[model samples]
Target chain A: MSELLNTLMQDARVWQGHRHNKTTTPSESTGYQLLDNQLGGIGWPRGALSECLVDQPGIGEIHLLLPLMQRLTGTGKTVFWLNPPHTPYAPALAREGINLDQVVMIQTGDGGDFLWTLENCLRSPVTGLVMAWPGKLATRDIRRLQLASESGSNVCVLFRERRYTDQNSPAALRLELTPGDHQDLKINVIKRRGSWPGQRCSLAMAHRADLAFRETPQVVQGPWHQSRR
Target chain B: MLWLYLHFPHLLLDHIRRDRQDQRPLVIVEGTGQHVLQACPEARNRGVQTGMRLKTAVTLAPELGIVRAQPEQDARILEDQARWLYRYAAHITLVSPDGLLAEIGSLQKLYGGLPAVWQTVEQALDEHRLTAWAATGHTPLAARLIARAGKGECTGDRGHILRTLETMSLATAEFDAKTCTRLQRLGLNTLGEVFALPAPELARRLSPEILAHIQKIRGTRPDPQAPWQPPHSFRQQADFVQEIEHSQGLLFPLQRMLSELEDDLCWRQQDTDSLHLILQHRHEEDTRLRIRTSGPEHRADGFLNLIRLRLEQQPLRAPVVALVLSVKRFIGREAPAGQDLLGKSQDLNEAWHTLISRLQARLGDHALKRLSPQEDHRPERAWSASEVQSKHKPRLTNPEHLPRRPLWLLQGPQPLTEPPTAWFSGPERISGGWWDGERVHRDYYIAQLRSGQLAWVFRDVREGWFIHGWFG
Candidate 1:
């Protein structure tokens, strides 16, 4: 009976509750101390799928991945961006110390092609990270991506609309982002691999003084504006 | 000076058999479509024989498939067979219409022995599904005569070859009809009977051509052979007996052609990035499909997969009768950097190239792109999307630093109807494009909207506010 139990425990399908804290999968730091602490003392899970849920664009979502991208490209690893919402501005990426030569941008036509490109990138050995904006995905799609990432030993992050917050996923980690006060991003860890859900962490995204909201300039009457006034 | 000759009795018939999948009774008729030139084994099994009239052969085998023979096509097929033989022997001569003469004496040591060389050629013939009669002789003419008689033996012994030649009939000696008839009238039915006569007496009785031919066959005279060289580019065509109705039916013949191309590329130590596939239709214009790879590739599997994907996208419009695969440009193969000679671990660059090729094959060729910065200040012109480079170049450190830019730039600026709640910085003027006649004067600012979205807003000379980008 003990030998049978040991064999059963070796199978990945059997989830043991007591072995939660002894996770052996490697992970990278998320660059936020509070979020890192909430994520079982490690950062983003490596060789696994992670999902980021956001309602709108430009709310510090891309800023959250800058550190990982910089670290990856600095070490001669490739980063793939599949079907991004907008153009990945080159000057901004270069300014962040990210190697543009190591970056590849892929734009696919349909959902099938998007999924195929995503899976290929995740399974490629030379890939450091794969970031995609897969609009909607089924449960099976996410599971396959998770398996591919685990096999390739790379990081894969999928950005989805905030409406998918209630749907269950097989990702290693899931986070929901909303705007916070004073240019801060409110990150709510809805689900984690080895931790309880609903942990909150606020991260400051904008560090440049020129990006903060200041007093509005007074309106000046010019020749072109005279007609409008 | 040992010579080897390969005699293909049914070259066109064998070629047609290789293209199709069925073992049907087939025969190659003369150019006049009157007599049978060659009969396949399936047809011969049914009592249909060569040199028989077309009507007679059709009666003998009612289900026989007849294909009219063309001398031009026969010559081409013979040359293709010689190309295959070039890999085994260095000096190959194309004997037009159905034979190849190769000097294999020098290759005996290279291939270990005469038997080894013969075995190698036999295995290659079997692999290609060809029926050939091979023989070795002291002279080229001797080898040809013995092989044509269907009594060829893979022996390099001078005495054995001479004895075999002497036993051949006068007809198999390949002499002109006039000379053979004259010699037969003189009571010389076999080649040995003619050789027994005095040389001067025979030369006086017959024309000088027969005497010179005999001397050359006996190795007393030199027979110069023009060596055959492989063409610079690969081009081969497969003509079918039955028309292929579906594009899928073309893959069978295409598989053989692609493997041949792979062998050619490997032999040349080169790779190609483009392949042109032409399909000939019976009534319509030829359909052409061009397959392209991101980097140089020489694998047949990769090319076949790309062709499959392309065919799936747009199928044939008519029944195809022939297929032509050709590659014009050849790229010299370079060993991948940082890869060990033993190849214990897969090269990362090769993996990257494979992924890119697979994506491009399924998706269109222009789906993937590389982003590089340009020397321009206009937000729209600040970056460029170009083809991915096969080799990655290291980035240079630019000493000049530019101002802040957004993470995501909109394709086109949208007019801002709602005013921003706060303005952080503004009025950094950019006025340019005057030399290009598309002048632009704008004041850019960082503004915070009511929804807390950081926007890169610009005001034109007309005082119209437009949102240009987002800081994602």
Candidate 2:
């Protein structure tokens, strides 16, 4: 009877009410305590697909992943960036404590390579994290990536436009991000496994104020300035 | 010392018949194309004997296929066979046209005994579908002569071999016709009868060349053989009787060749990164395809897959009659670095190499790149995208307390059209690149745009404002 119960529990369709509060999915910390609390203290889901919907390009999107990147790279695991919108600044990444030697960037010419590279990177055991910005992916494509991530036992994060929010995804965790007031970020947990969805959370992104010059530059009138006017 | 000799009666005939499925009669004619030098079993069954004139052979077996033998090509085939035999014996001498002489006296203990060594060669020949007459003798010439005479037996006993040689007729003694007639006239009907004659009298009667031949066969004079060494590069080709119209048809022959290469590489304990394939057409120029791997690889499956992808991408322009595969560069293989005492990392490096090569085979080599930071103040000059490296190197320590930079820098700075709605911080001056003509004197700022998108914008001293990068 116990062996039969174990086999039944292994099935995906089987759901037990008492097991709801216990999170069994392998997870890693997002490095942000507030976001960790927002995720029910389980942090980011590992060995699975997590989708992020962004409102704009900037607004601390990459900052949210800095802690995880540092942790993964520090352990000598490779991180692949596939078809990002812009060039990943090496100096910035290096400064953020990411090992430059462990980072690989792949640029694909067409949509087919974009999907192929994402899948290959996620399926490789050597890679610790696969971050991709696929322009448009089919439902089956997303499902394939989910399966590959589970098999490879790596973290895969797909960043798409907020326009894809309405389309259903097979990701284990889904979140939507928008710019918040006071240079902060607003995160809404759209979906997660074995947890209540629609959990809204906000995190402060004001640490970037140190990057700007605190004192203003004083400009004196010069002969070249007069000639240009 | 014990020596082994292998004589291939129909090397070229077997090579050609193995490529095709047809069981029709086939024969290899001499270079002059008049007399048949060798015949297959099918032709032999039809009573087309060796040394028969081409016309009569054709009359006997009308469906017989004849191929004119080229001495140079036959010698090359012999060398290929020697390469395969090198796996079993280290010291091998190539007796050209269709024979291999291997020094096996030193290798008897390594193989346990003479019969075991003989069995190993016989098994290899059977697996390759080859027919060879093998014999062992006390001398190289004796082994060659015994094998050529079709009285080969696996024995190392000097007395037994001598007894067998004694009963042999004078005709098969490999003597010139003149010496054979002379010996017969002297009432010497067999080699034993000839050996019974006094040595001084025989030496005085026979010419020095004939006398030396006898002494060499009798193991009185030392006959040294030049050892054949494997070539530095590997090259093998296959010719097809039927024209292969499709590129997919070439894979069957290529698979066999690649496996041979795998064995060759394994024997050498080396790996290769490149393979050159040439497809010969009837009327068109040859199509050459070069397949490369990211690192040293020896597995035939990996190479076959890469070649398949290459053929799929660019197909044959015309029907091909022959295909050649060559690998010139070989890398020394290093011990595998996997599975430490903890056994946590189980051949991950090998899997990584496979993934890189597979991705590069479908995508171009330049599609994948590694990013390493350089020591330049300029953002564009500070980073470089290079080909993936096989070895990992220590990383340079990044400078502490650096100003925050954007995660994504545009390929080139774009012009900013509108002013910012609010300025969080501004007027930080960055002026550099004076040594180079492309100087930059600008004041950068962190500003919030009207669309609520934070931008890293800078105003040039002589030019308008421009946006450089995004935080994402």
Candidate 3:
């Protein structure tokens, strides 16, 4: 029995290593040079679930999704929106280069059905991503979604949390975005796979006069130097 | 002259000869019982005329077939034919079910002469498997009489028109008995006799009506007519060189047509209420699929998204040869203008439009409904879905009550299993709709669940409990 217990502990380490080796697929830069650089020099960490928590309305949540949606839709792939609480402005999204034609919005009655639909969309090869607004989801549910996301190499799922939850989630990345003091925003990285949690970053946010999306984050000062001085 | 008015009324029979079974002396009957409307030329040849007793006609010709005359179908077909004729003549007027009067005055120069225009009309009729006898004169009444006389071989000139009128019988002249008696008293046996009289004397001897008829025959007055106007709707069509069996093949062409329609809507500064897609099959009748919007829209993305959803739900019935997108109704658009930085940040109208477009794209037009506040104090019957119209604005006079009501309400009360928790508040009673069958006696509650999520639930006096909505 002791020998069996010893073998089980060794097997658990192998599983832990597998989970730690979860790396995002190579993705094209989102054209926002500084923002892309901050986001590991890759766009929205492909083939994994990313949570974007926004406290205030119209800060930069929509602007961030615009580039991601545009890239997916531009490649002639389908994007499923599962139970989005707030309505999307079609003209605004169109100006951002996102092919609204490729986006399918599904309004489910409850959170349970919304998650079910997301999983179904992820299973399909034609589907590029599934973004959902589940008011509050449990950690087990997030784990199920993460597993599915890994299996479906072509698809990515995003959950926009309306209210904060205390449960430990298995999301590949958890970002807490809050409205900034001025015409800017603050991004707090809570968790990331195979990497240390990132420091809270502050960057300027400017609206494109002609286009719909927000101009990429421009660093006003280096975080290390500003804090040290 | 024995004017033989051979109205070859069995025109459809000649056209449908290949379908020999339908060629039996067929008469188009309309309505029911005693009111017999019309008979085909074949039935006419068999002595089965219009207004004749149905039983009598049946007994006279046992092999006589019957078809119900659909005036709407005939009108639609005739309208299509008229549109095609516009290519040949600038103005073409539909005189009757089978007759057309085109103004060849201007076309005479283009086609070389009046005879050339007549020949062109003849060729057009031949293409459609129809035969038309035409005549031209100074007056419309004279031209109509000459054409109805079945003088197809005759070239209509001033002298020819005069001779035709001279030989025409009083019955074929379309004059009433009283007018005929007056003409007879004046020793006028033919139209030429009436035309021979001086205009002032003719006016004195008879009424102005008779004089005007004479003038019309003499081409002295303008023959006024109201021309047909096509429906005020936008239509974008793409005919495929080769038939497409797959939906993917249709996407590119459909996108092009949609963009064109989008441009048109933008140019007009209007938004469409509903768009209909007509897929014309290779050999079958066209199939129409309609995409209606919850609210008026001009955005191409919104339109395309709705179309994609519909296509995903229901695929094509058959291979399509052509696709057409037609806008049924257009509403004027009023987009929000740029505001100053110090002013109120929210534009309720723009936000409302965005919400409606999103809902329309997700759920069908029927699914996305807006609760328009009615002029009633009762909470249950306060609002209803806005009906289809040009202008749709919610009459929410009581702004105080709106903040209390949930944005998304259940279509019908959902029956609940159990109730009660620490988070659930007191029941707010609402009982109404006694006149209608749906009488409601419910106590609504704003309940906060154990998970800290808020829900709108209600309890009935008889039917127990129901959960209605959730506050996000």
Tens-digit lDDT track for model 1 on B1-472?
8999899989898888998888889999988999999999889898888899999988888878889898888888887888788888889998877888999999999999999999999999998999999888899999999888878888999988888888889889989899999999998998888878888898899977888899888887799888889788888789888889988998889899999999999998999989999999999999988888767889998888888877876778999988999999999998766667786334676677777777777777788888888887788888888877574666564624856888888888889767776566666688888887877899988766678777788999887889888877
Task: DockQ each candidate and list the results.
Answer: 0.43, 0.37, 0.04
Q: Which TM-score values does chain B get in all models?
A: 0.91, 0.86, 0.46
> Which 10 residues in a row give candidate 3 chain B its minimum summed lDDT?
B1-10
How does each model score on lDDT? 0.84, 0.83, 0.59
lDDT of 3: 0.59
Scored against the native two-chain complex, candidate 1 gets a DockQ of 0.43
Error of 3 at B121 (Å): 4.6
Better of 1 and 3 by DockQ: 1
- Worst window of 10 by summed lDDT in candidate 2 chain B: B395-404
Q: What fraction of the native alpha-carbon contacts across the interface, defined at 8 angstroms, is recovered by model 3? A: 0.00
Interface RMSD of 3: 16.9
For model 2, the DockQ equals 0.37
- Each prediction's TM-score versus the true structure: 0.89, 0.85, 0.41
lDDT of 2 by residue, A1-229 (tens): 9999999999879977667676788888899999998898887788899998996787888888888889998887788888888899887788788987778888887887788778888778888888898888999999988987887777788998998988999999998988876567789999998888898888777565453333331222111222322
Best by lDDT: 1
TM-score, model 2 to reference: 0.85
Between prediction 1 and prediction 2, the one with superior lDDT is: 1
For model 1, residues A64-111, the per-residue Cα lDDT tens digits are 898999999988788899999899988888888888888999999998
Predicted candidate 2 versus true structure: per-residue lDDT over B302-359, tens digit per residue: 9999888878767789999878899999999987576698655646777777778877
